[model samples]
Target: MRREDDHPKEHCAIFGIFGNRRAAWYTFLGLYAQQHRGEESAGIASSNGKEIRHHKSMGLVSEVFDESSLDALKGHLAIGHCRYSTTGSSLAKNAQPIIVDYSRGTVAIGHNGNITNAEILRAQLEAHGAIFQTTTDSEIVIHLMAKPTYNNRIEGLKGALKRLEGAYSLVLMWEDELVGVRDPYGFRPLSIGKIRNAYVLASETCAFDLIGAKFVREVAPGEIVIINKNGLKSIKPFPEPKRKAYCIFEHVYFARPDSLVFGENVHNVRKRLGKQLAIEHPVEADIVIPIPDSGNSAAIGYSSESGIPQERGMIRNHYVGRTFIQPHQFIRDLAVKIKLNSVGDALKGKRIVVVDDSIVRGTTSKMRMRSIRESGAKEIHLRVSGPPHKHPCFYGIDFPSKDELIASKRSVEEIRKFLGVDSIGYLSLEGLLGAVSFDKKNYCTACYSGDYPVRFDENVSKFATER
Candidate 1:
């Protein structure tokens, strides 16, 4: 079993469709494109203008939905999600889209990112006689909507949503209507698309391609889109104009290169970032090898700038499950060993430079370094494609506390000692902006620089205790 300290990664891709019989199928395709956002579980809910039904399970999209299950959820409107647990344990109850029944209507909701204030809200709700059925913060929405003080359910949701203080992109299904909302800072991505006569709401533009939908605009920060037979209505929940703090990591490591976010192409941005990294940290090496998947783009840039050939020296076993069989400590170390192996012939006697997206705790990097050394590499130079994470991520990422962050209190030389590498380099702060086409003034880099766009009291640590 994995250690308890290895907190389950929590993130999800949310999709919604309205005014289409093929919505359930289309949402399935959307979830496929966004599968990288989460991997622990997946689910879908559909509405036929009268009743809402759903199917959710613990697995990837394909494993969760077979031919029969997909067919069973036919509706003119639908919303889907792929889950990664954060707040609650990794049980079936934590899966999305979470469907609940109330006197007003049946609401199925899918959300991305964490709500920092969930525990306080939960306690307040319970004190007022609200009975909760799930430990998920997502369920808090049901209680918020069930309040009788509001004129209607939508207004009640808006009130509850306004009181929230952290990152979230919500997709709510109310009877026949499918609604999508983005937090004021747009810490998460959500977009609107069109598939012939239908409207689609998804976490990324790549989902549009999967469902044969034409890419439309993103859901503006603090904006909400309501879709039903009457058509789409937009709502802006935040007051005044606030600068957006879109997560910069979304372009750096999280999103698929094929996707378009905030009118910027992900693949192109990554290539540019690679070029910038090379300009900032020039290095001489026999070959530059990416750490696979996330590291590919930055590696290519490092290769082009250093005039070194880009070689696939390290190969990842795509079949490896997130959790490995580690019956003992030695076996656990071996589990990390088999996850990635070096291309022996490519690395023999060669001075290698390794590039990866980021190093969370340095354990994985140390293990990978050892793997390369075992393959008979003469020299190993490590290059990180992103800035050092000096602070914990309060939004959604599973980063460790400040004490656990190597960069938080250590210098480059110290980090090299911790990871056992000959030479180490990281992309510069400017290199971060060089990776994206958008203006630096708008993006969020709080995790890297400790300059949070939204100021919260230091007591914010108490939020975790509440959850």
Candidate 2:
């Protein structure tokens, strides 16, 4: 059986550097820092102002490229991608920084979000005799750019972007220029950074931190930035929407705690969310323990607000890969057990409060609760940092369908009973928005409130482009 994480799968991470001799190395480091965003595969493409060369494989950044591989991709401008297969099957052919040589010139692209309208567009293009190599929606961009219909416009990139209907934060290497683009709705995060004279663009500011680069600013919702020998140039190709739909889940779970996304620090925002959760659902407990890694910041805030001591009740095995095979049917819950083991000494005979980012399908959460109960904990109060995820997400996040969500049909009390916890509390939608600095209307709470900013066909599967 295919083993999946309890949480929503993360989107891809994109990185690019211009005017740096060690561009490929820096890109590799950037990808390494943002590996949490994607872990299935990694690739890097570089341009030497003349020819474009690339190396990609179905593995981690450290596994895919070595010193010799980096040396072989010699260039002053480079772009990289680490992927999680949001739209296509996990295969070597789908690994990206997908390079192509067309009529305009050699161009490579690293994309971080999904295209909701790819199925419709692909059908139209195929009707006119267009050929495609990969099943990924990312490849549609290249075909659109190469088509005479879009290329004949003022600019091929802008024209192609105008036709797209969902989230996309792109890093493109077109000949000698490095390009970055964010969709008009701003459903994903992309930022600009600088190191010495070189310009950098990445999915998160944390990538800049790893390579000794300084955070510059975020690429605006509808903006496209081009970096070449002359300087950096900006263009607003699409009209601004009535409101921006920045994904709030980035703060709750996706981004690294040290990274800055959407003009706010992720760690601070998550702490605030935890504080809010404590305010809404205060529980009397002797100790607060996080789910680990993603839940650490929130647990700290919970402990601070409630005056409960914080402890590591459960330890995670970081070396465990994303997926593993189930050797036998009798070995149930082995995936969860392998990833986390309860600290019996810390949990035995203690009133424990467990904090986690969110509960998706509840399979892993149920198993975790059973493990805690087996450790002799007197009481187990489960706290979630965000509101219940009741709807499917179409803007890159790999959430299951609505029916698969535990909260979609069950009431809070029912869910608590199912998980076998003493009580369960999730942060309210209003409380979640209050934790962020931006206006409440600027955020997308579709997964909680079913208020999608962009409209899409309900019947279309998220993996419609997959063959």
Candidate 3:
């Protein structure tokens, strides 16, 4: 199967609660906290010692669950997921917190990242009488755990996790306990948190704060933490190599600015990236304007460093979902305009520096620049808060195909000409890593350098090659 390289890896968010009778509510709140990580669909599964109950549907967390629905779910151990598809096509059947019933028992798994060997593993399982339930790699883990070789459940979990490759931070729920496992490379983010007498597992620390769960510590790279009535027990040294390379994009755009991952404060890291970008490619402009939401944080950083006043030059229509099948060119063109509009009054006759999170297809940026120009901005200087995406990401990001990526083929000057901007600059790779204060060996800059942390098969390798 060909990889969908153009599709942004909708790095999912996973949240789980152990020991709380109100597990569903806390799981719902935790998933809501991580909604920025993904928004295509949501699901929650709860287990009350005897059986597992779940409610899953396509849509945002708010749209999927309400007061009545949460009331019906009963359990002390639960897991919730906010997902964006990466491995397979977007379909209702692929929505997660995938529940499975097998010879061992019932289990529900909510996963936060992609698996490179998912197809191979799925094929093996299918040959051995494992009936596939969903298109996600997450279900593979459930099948693996159900294998009869291991002496105990924890050993089964470790054995299963060891078989997988690529990015993953998974939370699996059984009848009595919630288990959290991070991949050996720690390619994705997972942490442990606590509220009064309860333990939590989540993709980001921000999810902990949402439910007033105190940040205890991160679930170490290859560690498995089991949360049950007894307390938190970590199966240490579960099998890690040397350094940890959490996906750097978690800080760049996918995460909510308030969230913290890999010990880096996301908002501050973005601001630092913008400040450094200004230093690398300073532009003379009257006001600094952000591309809204994602760019706002970095724009402030740019304004602070460049001594430019930060202004609201563009406004986004949050009503638009991530994907739309307009079918016709005219409708697709109109969708872009409807998704975002420049504040004509604020932009008029100003020397503007437009700061944005990152430019992928460049079509969106091109349209935004044209809108700002139409709004009468005298001079538009473009600044990106992250390095130009020179290669595609296989871990879990929805970067465009190599040919569609502006940076993949065009130089800075050519990109400026194409975007109709006076000057264009992207945050340097060093500056981006520095902004996040990441150890060089522990951050994946694969999209910028084509140096993936994990090995891949021939087909998967094609997804990362520069066109």
lDDT of 3: 0.82
TM-score of 1: 0.94
Please give each candidate's TM-score: 0.94, 0.98, 0.93
Task: Summarize candidate 3's per-residue lDDT along 179-238 as a digit string, tens digits.
Answer: 898877788888888899889988888898888989888888888888888888888645
List candidate 1 stretches off by more than 4 Å.
Answer: 3-10, 457-467
Poorest 10 consecutive residues by lDDT, candidate 1? 1-10
Instruction: Provide the lDDT at 466 for model 2.
Output: 88
lDDT by residue for model 2 (46-105), tens = 989999999999888889999999999998999999998753488898999888888788
Model 3 lDDT, residue 160, Cα? 85
**Residue pairs clashing, model 2:** none
- How high is the lDDT of residue 222 in model 1? 91
lDDT per prediction?
Answer: 0.82, 0.90, 0.82
Q: Using alpha carbons, what is the TM-score of model 2?
A: 0.98
| lDDT of each residue in 1-467, candidate 1, tens digit only | 56322321438899999978977888899998898888889999998888988999888898899889889987889999998765345788778998888767889999897787777787888898888766777888778877778887789789888878778999999887889999998889999999888999999999998778998899989998888787889988788445888888888888888898877888777777777777877776899899887889888878887888999988878777645556777777776656678898999989998988888778778888888988988998898878888988777776677888878988988999888788988888787976676678788898789977765555656234323
lDDT of 3 at 172: 89
